[model samples]
Target: MQFLYGVQLLIMILMPLIQMVMKAIGIGFVSYLGSNLIIDQAMNYIVSQMSGAGAVVQQILGLAKIDVAINIYFSAITTRMVLSGLNKLQDRKRAQVWRAPGGTSIEA
Candidate 1:
């Protein structure tokens, strides 16, 4: 019937657009998981640990009457190192693909 043909034509026309939207949503969900679940938690833990270490160093310098400016320098260096490490980690995660023992690829 003409109605059946029209329905088929409409579905054919819409399929690609539907697929494109689904792909975009999948990508966005993965990005959200990577940033919110992984990176943010790791950054928080790193910053907290670094701050504790910096505090200890500050105390030692304070006792020695050394200028506290050195603490600032060390903090800057530590931050850069942490950022570089996190960037490498992010890149590695992005590049990695998981596979099963049976040679099947797993997708995110």
Candidate 2:
């Protein structure tokens, strides 16, 4: 982490890998802050599409709840980013399992 914070060394060594980590970090922050309005809306739409999501959202939203408008703002941001992180983690795990006998794919 320290190595990447220095621009000169980062471009040569850590740039490629760091880009993804940076993106995940950004998405996480964006979803956390509810700053990414369109993304949050899209997430709500997707969740609503799911069969059990309506009831689940309702149940979760009902108890120990904050204000309606505030809840919408908070929920929109958090749910999407959390889902995105989970999806990425699942994909990474799948890739790990699919690797060849030697572990890594290339001669790095």
TM-score: which candidate is best?
Answer: 1
**In model 2, which runs have C-alpha deviations exceeding 4 angstroms?**
1-10, 35-88, 95-108
Candidate 1 collision pairs: none
Pick out the ten consecutive residues of candidate 2 with the lowest summed lDDT: 62-71
Error of 2 at 52 (Å): 33
TM-score result, candidate 2: 0.29
TM-score, cand. 1 vs. native: 0.42
lDDT per residue (tens digit) for residues 1-108 in model 2: 675568767586778789889998997787657656765676577556543557766676656363365558667666876788789888887744455656566644
| Candidate 1: tens digits of C-alpha lDDT, residues 27-108 | 7688657655654565567556645667778577568655455446455756776688689778987954656655466545
Q: Write out the backbone clash pairs for model 2.
A: none
Model 1: how far residue 47 lies from native, Å: 5.5
**Who wins the lDDT comparison?**
1
TM-score of every candidate = 0.42, 0.29
